[model samples]
Target: MNELFDSVADGLVDKSYAIIDNFLTTDEVAQILTLPHFNQHEQLFKKAGIGKNADLQINEAIRGDYILWLDKNTAPPAAMVYLNRLNELIQHLNRSLFLSMKDYEVHMTVYPVGTYYKRHLDQFKKDDHRKLSVICYLNTNWKEEEGGQLRIYTDHDSFDVLPVAGRLVCFRSDVLEHEVLPATRQRLSLTGWILDQQIM
Candidate 1:
């Protein structure tokens, strides 16, 4: 835990974002992916949409994926364990960086073949409580040619963050513009946000 916390903290302090490989162990990734919610509840993963609340709309051209939000009150044991880890990370960040994060939310996401998400910032006007964006990849044996990379843009340069197993990406939600490039195979990930107290 110390290793991960320190690495993430230092990365955020230095670049406003961080990409950590081996954030989860093989067993841990298996635990998350094999849960009944993911294995048996495929119907629950509704089509993802753009915008929030009243403005939300399903536009396949812009975003193409399915998502199943982890329910805080009813998440399975494996999920609860994962969420607990995130809670601990939140505590670490609040103590070390004074991020003042009050809560966290996560969802299991899947992008089928050829799916992709257009470039956009994580923060939205009406639901601006999102302070940080975190995503953990679950795909094993991923290859460069598979093509589902996270393309993050900065003022001077842009780079691709591969969706490889056990890899984690964290960034200031409002500071970066990123997009999911099209993939040749299925892509799976656990994604979430760290929110301020005002959102709770």
Candidate 2:
């Protein structure tokens, strides 16, 4: 696990983003999928919105996904496992990069078929506390043809990442402009931000 953490840190230093495959084991991914929030997403999830607080708004044209925020205190054992791992990563990043990240906020997101989020940066205009953006895909047997790829735009180019189970994508929240592509099938994932300020 330290080796993996080192690789991610190195990627951030060299490039600003990293893509790691099989970050979670098959069993671990299956366990997360069994969580009540994921199984009952339709009932428990709320529509995702853009901006923060008073500026928050739900416009399907901008983004069309449902989200259920995860609370470690009440999370199931399987979910706790993932959260604990993230805590470890946070510590490693703080020590290695001096990011001063205080905590992470994550949610289970489900995008229905043919829904997408337009290109945008993860950091909000009024808030720059989000330093890192992380996503771990949970779609089993996902194919390129399925279409829900994350397109990240860089200074001179861009690239697409397929939403495959156990695949992890991490990038600088304030620096990257990215978007989700519409898919033929539902897309599921754990998505979040590593923040410099504590989230209350």
- The top-ranked prediction according to TM-score is 2
In order, the Cα lDDT scores of the candidates are 0.88, 0.92
Please give each candidate's TM-score.
Answer: 0.95, 0.97
Distance from true location, Cα of 180 in model 2, Å? 0.3
* lDDT per residue as tens, model 1, 1-200: 77898788888889999898888888888888887655544577889999988999999999998999987779888777778878888889889897789998899999989999999999997878899999989999999999999999987999999999989899999999999999999899989999996443
The residue-by-residue lDDT of candidate 2 on 99-137, one tens digit each, is 789999999999999999999999988999999999989
Compared with the true structure, the alpha-carbon lDDT of candidate 1 equals 0.88
Prediction 2 TM-score vs. true: 0.97
Clashing pairs in 1: none
Worst 10 residues of 2 by lDDT: 33-42
Q: Which candidate number would show the highest lDDT if scored against the true structure?
A: 2
